[model samples]
Target: MIREGVMNQAQKLLAGLKIPALQAPMFLISGPEMVINACKSGIVGSFPTPNARTPEILDQWMAEITEQLSSAQNPAPWAVNLIVHPSYPRLEADLQVILKYKPPIVITALGSPKNVVEAIHSYGGVVLADVVNTTYAKKAASAGVDGLVLISAGAGGHTGYLSPFVFVNEVRQWWDGAIVLGGGISTGKNVFAARAMGADAAYLGTRFIPTKEALCVDEYKQMIVEASSDDIVTSDAITGVKANWLRQSLLNAGLDPDNMTAKGKIDFASNGADNKRWKDIWAAGQGVSASESVSDVSSIVNLLAREYVSAASELTQTLKPGNRE
Candidate 1:
């Protein structure tokens, strides 16, 4: 049976869905087209506000996604990811737009989202915060966020080093609100594992990076396909935030992954959409090794759905109650 609080935000939000998964709001990569496909395929789609480079463009994206997804057949709820930190100069303005439209879900990153909780709550939107540890998860719970996304090791971009198993268990001890597990989730079996581990759903990023709908360069997508876990390097070098990047991308930037001088600062003002910051320094996860080729969102979701059902059936025989070895 599904847990009690697990159905609070996630269930109401995703009332009727094929798989309980949310395509992570990747910076620059997740745009209108990608978000549209994810929703069209009966999954939550999202994108970061700063990916538009300007608030005006963000407004356009919001309008486009809202119109398209709302009219789509049996569309799933969509979300917007906001960097709720002081460093982002346009946080207030971008948040204004979000509060205006009020997508079903709002995901906050970088810092506490307590300040916006009241406003977001006013519009009946659920706020989900990204947390790496119990500290941030408790902070988000105190802030009245509807859910928490545990970003653990093997996740792409600004990932945590903790194991998802340990972090999820720790968070559950204090809070039982909606929990979304991220990192190392590349397939449907992984999503099932997340739910079994007490998560309401799973959040995936790198798996979507190589998809056809993503707004990424062909080279970056191909690099994700060609690389593996060892090809992923974690360091606070790219954006002054500890994140995973493809080692080959570092080589293309004329830097050695093992030893190099990295001068990373929080430059929220700069645009990395098509420039060296992101274009040359690709952000990926250890799960990139699972990405075999470039495909569409629907195809990937279809494969995940099939895999999830198969895994669930297989677990009935081996992971049943009192069957532990």
Candidate 2:
């Protein structure tokens, strides 16, 4: 009965996204402006709760996004990303902020979200657990999470090793619940492809990094424009987890891109490595290849919508009138 309840709640929350897409909450990239504008464009917008410098700022960001959405003629719900890991000393504190605001959706990553699922559900909020493989997917589903975010290989941050084609099908084999796929999903074609592959929605990040609403520096945006799939390097040196980052950022920090090592386990409470961290050296997905320059959130979403319609129309023509794939 609890699973059934969560399943309905997950679908209800996601249904608010008119375009069937949700922006991925990237570290140091997602912020209030980004989330607000994206929601205004009829898609789910989101930011990690930890992105705020302090608890006060986190509260302010949540309030601003909520107020703006409430006043809009037609707006989609927003989401918050919570690091459920213990090393994050602010996890409990951030959860309190979420409880106060009760954002429509909460996405948990990096640790067990069992307790978080219960707390969020108590307030009628939806919880989506982030997983890289079937092992984590089964565990999260058993914990009563409303949905699962399949972070396959080519994803920007702390990526999974399996391909999306393999991982999505494998997860669907066992769970019939809501599943959103994330990896190198950048284009409108990719968004349509995700739905065709049995995903409820596409989780996108790298493509949004170059938007004006993002909080990153100018150079970071340019680097993303200059990057391609080959320029990305997966290494655990920065965050103590194997994440995809720009190869040039590592070279800029004076580290041998091929031979890098971490001196200690990562502390989620603080910025990654003391000397070189995400602030300087950045992380992005293989999807950067599709990104060319910076633009506003509205324009970007408009472009994706046009592309999605065109691609869907093209795909529709391939099948016979009365036949299904």
Candidate 3:
């Protein structure tokens, strides 16, 4: 039997899915199409608030998505991502829009605020906060976040340096609300590994860049398809934030991956003040090496489910007969 705490959280999140996997809300890549497809597949889907340029547009998108899903009789829960940084001038305005819709889940990144958590809870919505280390996890927990997403090493944009083993182990030692493990998780075996390490689910971003529902450019998708672990580079030069990127993309953009220097400034307003460079920079995690093709979201999820079942069966076989340890 599943642990009562874990089961309750998983049931709340799964929304009838067999596995606990969420398509991490990519900055610009995650859109309504992607979220819709993931939800249709019975997995949690999400998109960032900034994906919409105005509060009016955000409200329209939420209404359309809610209506479309309800009409289809699909019960999978959807989430909205909020950039809790003060730099986002429209944070409060966007929060107001989110309040009107009350998505089943709200994912807060960059910073977690007590009031934000309180607001979501007031509507019976769950709040999941993304944290890079134990320190941030503790801070989010203190803020009353319902779940902690451990963005461990090998993850895509804005990743952490801790191994999932160390990160999850440390967090589980104290906090026990709900935990999701991220970073280099591209396969079913990885999902099993995360659960074994005490995570309630796997958060995936880079693995979905090549999916048909993603809003990435063709060149970007091709790069992910062709690259491997050795082809990725971690640097803070592009966004003034340390993140993993495809090394070939850096070289293609005429930058030396080996000798790149940090500009020591984060210009969220540079590149036409529209976040254009990030579109070309191409963010991916160490697990891109495991991706073999660019397929649709449904196909990718089907493949992952197949592999997960096969892995579970193999584990059962290993423990049966005289093959047990």
Candidate 4:
């Protein structure tokens, strides 16, 4: 996604961030506390609009996020994700809430963001579209979004198939605005690597799922802490969309990971049955192995900041003219 003025808007948005990253929005998992904490911790915090249960709740959540962030010292900006797909019954209603809150950033998923681009831009909001392939990326760029969140291979729920390296390189050829790469990004070194790969930021979701502010139960977080890359299974059987899930979670939900088949459909309705399925069969990315334990958002961010600095320093020394082989 790209636009003339949007490039400036993206710069302003990124300028306030302590790190070049976003706490990728998660359905039913991310909420106000998570968003607030993530922002306060010097990174963009976000959650899907549907997580609020209704448009009114969405309004409340936005208000809460804005109100809390208002007084924080040097807090990073916050974002809200919207399901712009025509089939989503709440698109119009959610847009209304979004317009009122005017979050610094708005992320669109599951459809073209063209419809809401003008509205969001009218309020000086940056619109970033979630795309998994080059086709979607081109379409979103044409639609004039401020940026594109590339959901590459190894992402958790509603995953992408392309490797981050290939996806970022392909998109960078034509779109140089802002590319936030999501998938298998859990550590600070990964964040630095995203920049090295020509991405503006790293989109992290699974790494934060076990954080204290996440809405999931303790058991889900525990499972993430215990799992590894080998324990991740990709299948559309659960949500009718290709997604990564914890192998043990699938078995716990009585579905064999190896033979998993589409059983549920995509539905963003707050009370949709799909919610139950997601709640029961937890989703996580291959990066689960990096999570050592459940921790606070601030602590995790601090750790990432430390690791990012360390990685940058190491790379700098390695690239020195004298050190190079």
User: Which ranges in model 3 have alpha carbons more than 4 Å from their true place?
Assistant: 1-11, 267-274, 320-325
Give the C-alpha lDDT of model 1: 0.87
User: Which predicted model would earn the best TM-score?
Assistant: 4
Q: Which residues of candidate 2, in runs, are more than 4 Å off?
A: 1-7, 261-264, 272-276, 322-325
At residue 325, candidate 1 shows an lDDT of 60
**Which tens-of-lDDT digit does each residue in 1-325 have in candidate 2?**
2243444667766666667789989888999999999899988898988789788999999999989999997888889999898888888889999999999899999987898988899898989899998999999999998789999999998898898889888988878778889999998889889988978889999999988898999888889999999999988877788899899988998877788776336678664442248887889999997888888888888888888898999988987878855
The Cα local distance difference test for each model comes to 0.87, 0.86, 0.82, 0.90
**RMSD in Å for all candidates:** 2.6, 2.4, 2.6, 2.3
lDDT of 3 by residue, 1-325 (tens): 1245444553467536656788889987888888888878767889998887788999998998798778755547889999886566777899999999999989898776666988888888888999999989989989988888999999998888998999998998888777888999999888877877888888889888998888878888889989889988998888767789899888887889998796535644342453666766778999997678888877877787888788888888778677665
Q: How many backbone clashes does candidate 1 have?
A: 0
Looking at model 1, residue 315 earns an lDDT score of 87
Q: Higher-TM-score candidate among 1 and 3?
A: 1
User: Alpha-carbon error at 3 in model 4, in Å?
Assistant: 12
Which ten residues in a row are the worst by lDDT in model 2?
Answer: 1-10
Candidate 1 C-alpha lDDT tens digits along 1-325: 2355445764467546779899999986999998889989888999998888788999998999989987889898889999987777888999999987789899999999999989998988999999888888888889999889999999998898899999998887877678889998999999999989988889999999988888888999999999989999998877888889999999999889997457578666555533458767889988997789999898999998999999999988787577766
Give the alpha carbon lDDT tens digit for every residue of 155-185 in model 4. 9899999999999999988886888999999
Q: Candidate 4 at 74: error in angstroms?
A: 1.6
Better of 1 and 2 by TM-score: 2
Candidate 4 TM-score over all chains jointly: 0.95
Model 4 / residue 219 / CA error / Å: 0.3
